[model samples]
Target: MSRSWVEAERAMVRRTRLRISALVALAITVLVAFVGGIAYTAMVHAQDAQVKRELRYNAQFGSPSVPPGCTWLFVLADGVIDDGLIPVPPGFPLHGDLDAARVSGQTIEREIERNGTEYLVLSQPSGAGRTVQTVFDKRYQLADRRHLLLALAVAEICGLLAAAVTGMGVGRGTVAPLAEALARQRRFVTDASHELRTPIARAYTRAQLLARRAAAAGLPVDHRAGLDKLANSIRGLGDVVDDLLLSARLNEQSAGPDGQAVDLAALAEAAVETEGERAGERRITLTVDRPAGPLVVTGVETALRRAVDELLANAVRHTPEGGRIDVRLRRDARGYVELTVADTGGGFDPVEADRLFDRFHRRPAGPDRSFGLGLALLREVVTRHGGTVEAISHPGRGARFTLRLPAADPGVVAGAGAEEVSTGFR
Candidate 1:
């Protein structure tokens, strides 16, 4: 499958998940706000109702009789502000709004704050010329309301955090099927590639046999040339298939017998020398710089060699004839062994840097030798080795590709192959 189509499928899955998660979170937030508002309002209204009930009871059954913790003021023949009835709390302000409300013969209640305390005052006209005023301390009620508000605020914050976490979980769950399908596709590629190996080997054998016959019989030069080309094509196809299978299977990695300590500096020197010969053929200058001491790592030597070879191969292919290629190995500040290949070639567009490692992503007018799977497989292999790789480039300037592997201590490398087993096939 093409890379774009696979990316589109993943994009669709992510979009669907985001929309579903967003809608769910929005619905939950709205529901929580509605429920909280209703509950808070109910509690406030119930407290007000309790105050009003107390005011009514005091006004009806009391003329000369007064409640224990409540004050009453009268405004009638019998309902005068009788000082003998009850002693008023000090510094209480009597506003003109009270007289206007009594003249309109409407019951009015208002909260008053005095001396850092809250009080509820209710003024009501019981009958003609009978206005009764009562006051109740609301210090405890207001404090309870403040505590409830604080609790509600805390609940809201916690709920939002939980909703965000749940949304992430839901998104993953929703996209599980799409992820599984991609996995199945990779597995199919691996299986098909594995199945085609024997047939390819047989074809290669047949082509070699034909070439040998043409050379001995001297039938025609085209016979030899065409058969050689056929053999080369078959071999290339087999290589491509092998690469595909390896890329698919790299996720399931294990430390095998060949996963012994490797001298990184030595490996790099060998790759440079091998590629130096090829670079000479292209008239490109190849250079290598390394530390005097050995830089070691715990990994498969063949895999690391392939990685360096691929980078150098890319450099040679991209660089113009007589252009320069520099391969360097050094220890980074983080104690990682870094291998860098820089070439004076036509570099790629910077905007596409992020997609350089994606499978089947061929640059426009790229080299014919590339199947667009080299960097992708390189990424998988390096990541499995606990390393990282990146390409740095700018158009019309040049390109530099870097591979960094964590350096291994000499002691660790020495202890690696305590039990030497069979050296397996690559």
Candidate 2:
């Protein structure tokens, strides 16, 4: 896919996550506000109703008059206090909004402060243009409301925080697939670059030969060698491309119908046979040590063959002329099989040994070195076969490269229930 298209999709996912989080937060805020408003109004309503009922009962019954924590003041039409009532509570206000209540003979409730105490005052017209005011202390009710408001505020904050955390998780989850795709794209590019270096080198070498020939002789040059080199380079490039595509396909197939079981020992022997000519060209001594039992593994035969070829080729390249190269295959007690390639070459620094499997990584001291893709390709194939590759070397000491794979079970058709293992570089 195009980079722009991928970016647009990711942007849309991010926006969706943000919108979902915002909607959740908004819903919670609205719910809390609605519930809190109802609770506050109900609390105030109950307090007012209670005060009103007490006032009306005392006025009608005239028995034991005012209730505890409540006070009353009756203002007659001539502005005189009623002498028939009991004494009012200390710090309670005598004057309320009498004029306002008497204007329409309706109850006027207001919060009043007198002598440093708060009260809920209800003023209403009693009769004959007189006003009766009822006062109820509100210290405890106001405190309760404050605590309720604090609790609601805390709840609102917690709800917002939870929404934010959930939004972050949603965003990461949404982007995970895109991130994996981008990673695969980058890996393809790296692998392709590493593979292309070979053809480019071949082409450059052929061009140099043509240049030297033209410089030596006059005008018309022989196109045969040049054409042959060009063809070989193109063929090599095509082979690398095929190998890369096959590697990708193998990696992509997680639990599909993988190929049948192949004998690993036979594969290693075939690799040794194939690489024998190449080692002979450099006068290198190559040997293979096989275990008595047949070492079988479940994987693609072509891929496994390529893996062995790459390993042997690597050992031949690193080993000096007439050096010894040993290929050994062994099965351990833990039902794991290992293939080791130990060569008596001028070894590299052990610290940098692990980087040998990385694409295009080359040792500076190596002579006539090609772009480093052989080891990397080998690692990829082995990893797909549920195997791991390891590089063991030290400066001045020969390098030992090993491939460890899960051994196939002896029973039940001898090959099943195997999974690819994640591996590190050789």
Candidate 3:
């Protein structure tokens, strides 16, 4: 495998592992937060219940001076008040509640905050117009809640860490098979293409020879035509095989340090020239417009040339007699090389534009129907070189294909002049 392919595989594995880890950690975090919330809520409810029970018991039976720890008592009987010996902590017994309970002969309870802590107070009528009030501190309960929260926080952190470790292990096991399958598929294509090339070439060559001999021997015109058709079929098959091999090879390669700076303008001119004769046979007008200077991009020359050729060939194939096909190359404002092929032909539907680059995707039955690998391979080449390809078309209008590739350093073409020029072939 090429270095680029290996690096791509490694990058895919890393991304998968990271995504798995993130998902697992998120699930664990939500679970920990939910469980902790429930636990904290239940603890707070139980503590409140306990505090209320203690305060009610103290109000009914405890003496004013001998109350329990963290508790204070007050009594109001026949308008004479008696409080505990200990000094009241700032906001002591609620006198309003005590009077209300004594007059109403009912119980009253409330919670109050003071001095950065909480207090639960209860006032109730003991008997014979006597009112008893109890005050309980909530600082101890608050402290226990704080301790529980700290423990939950610690547990949540530990669970996230464990989730990350487990996710990494699972991701490696999950992604291994996928990576191996891709590698195997690529290998199979390369091997099969190599195995089929020689036989296909031989068959195409023999077919052509047979057609030429049949004509030389004064065979009937129908026989000669059949041989010619056979030759064309073999040639088309060979082209498909060649396309498969190139696609596999391009996948393994990338525009790295070993790549050379190639002039995109020159490649466009050459492609137009190569297709000129075929376009002429169909009476189509073919042309190329480019900058006078070399629009240099870094890539494999053969692959770039093939991409340019495919674009021109596609245009020529679709264009009707007397229609026009134009190829243009230039350096765009973004400092990237751009090549566009536009043709006056029976264009495809707008919705089908994106699918045109799919491997083996074919249009409706027509004389120009193809195996559909050319555009697909072309896109693969452009993408491997850090570029983009786009198609635009509407039914009955012409189609346009645009390819953009990152420009090489200006230093590579420093002295090359930049002037607009157009070349036309009838």
Best by lDDT: 3
lDDT of 2 at 115: 54
**Worst ten-residue run, lDDT, model 3?**
417-426
The sequence of per-residue lDDT tens digits that candidate 1 reaches over residues 1-426 is 445446655666677767766776677678778887898899899988987787778766665344546555444434245434456666542434346556898878787888578777777777756666667777777887888878777877777777676667766776767676876798699789889877887888888888888899997887787787677567655655665565565543342213567778887887787677679998999988888987888776656767887888888988999999988899899989999999999888888786989998877677676788878867866887889998999677689999999888768667745622222211
Clashing pairs in 3: none
Model 3 scores a C-alpha lDDT of 0.81
Kindly report which residue stretches of model 3 are placed more than 4 angstroms away from their true locations once superposed: 1-11, 53-72, 76-119, 122-131, 137-158, 185-259, 290-293, 330-337, 352-373, 383-388, 406-409, 414-426
RMSD of each: 10.1, 14.3, 8.2
Q: What is the C-alpha lDDT of each candidate?
A: 0.73, 0.69, 0.81
Return the TM-score for candidate 1, rounded to 2 decimals: 0.54
Off by over 4 Å in 2: 1-259, 364-369, 411-426
> Judged by lDDT against the true structure, how good is candidate 1?
0.73
TM-score of each: 0.54, 0.48, 0.65
Candidate 1 off by > 4 Å = 1-26, 35-121, 124-129, 133-176, 196-259, 269-281, 291-294, 348-362, 365-373, 390-397, 415-423
lDDT (tens digit, per residue) of candidate 3 on 320-412:
899999888888899889999999988888898889999988776955647889889888788888899999985686899999999988665
Best-matching candidate per TM-score:
3
* Tens digit per residue, CA lDDT, model 2, 327-390: 9999877777889999998777888777988998886655565877888877777777778999
Using TM-score as the yardstick, the better of models 2 and 3 is 3
Superposition TM-score, candidate 2 onto the true structure:
0.48
